[model samples]
Target: MPKITDQVSDSGIYLLEIVVPDDFYTEIKKYEGRKFPKGFYYYAGSAQKNMRKRLERHLKKNKNIYWHIDYLTSRFNIGKIFYFNNCGKEFECDLVADLIEKFGLIPAAPGFGNSDCNRCDSHLLYSEAPLDYSHFISRYQSIARFIPSSNDTF
Candidate 1:
């Protein structure tokens, strides 16, 4: 299916919601030296002006592994991409914090995709089951949208 988004702003926070298959968890641990259990993960990030470019780059399989998120996105498919467009730059970590505090999400890998963030243990959050995206958005109280697929080109 074609990826859809409601791009109403130039910048805000986003969550790359991905599912790591049970068997692939071992491969990720071996390659990245990080223990990630089989489950859903949410990686919170932000863009100042080029949110589309950033999101597009993240969904591609063929890209140079620059950021920690690149390691996972290069291998696993992002099941969903959530965009919170009305927030400021600081909302990236805020989103992660909310996931942990309200939704009981746990940090998967320390310093994973949050090198500059001191507020979060990791940008990547883990849960055994899928996070209720709509519920989370209702609690978030901000302008948001979600792209249902990641593999398809925009």
Candidate 2:
């Protein structure tokens, strides 16, 4: 397990906890006619360089929507962020797979945030109930640092 840091750094895997207040439908680029239900969602991603900048971009309301997660972040609110610094991209896929295996979470959008990934179904996981971050950490035995939306400086 890697050391979790408070500030986002060069390389790591991150999980964004987002809230969707109402049900809606949107065409997520290639994933057309997808329905986003009203609930909590966990989006996993990895940034090999400029991780802090990437996270800052996600925290912002206005930006160029290049990624699928950007589409959701533009519309929804990210409540929390859990990240493990120095973790590789492969860890991201493992985390997503673990979420599905343990929590039986389904993809909010197929092929979302994982266009470059060939191993995972999707990087975004949906659940009606709030996810237990501590449980996830213990299950994976991986250290993670929490960043609330209120404390996002960048």
Best by TM-score: 2
8-115: candidate 1 lDDT, tens digit per residue:
367778888888887444334433654567889889998878787788888889999788788788888799878887578798887788889899999987877787
Residues 52-79 of candidate 2 have per-residue lDDT tens digits of 8888788788888888888888888888
TM-scores, in order shown? 0.85, 0.87
Stretches of candidate 2 off by over 4 Å are 1-6, 140-142, 151-154
- Against the true structure, candidate 1 reaches a TM-score of 0.85
- Model 1 steric clash pairs: none
lDDT against the true structure, each candidate: 0.78, 0.81
lDDT of 1 at 133: 68
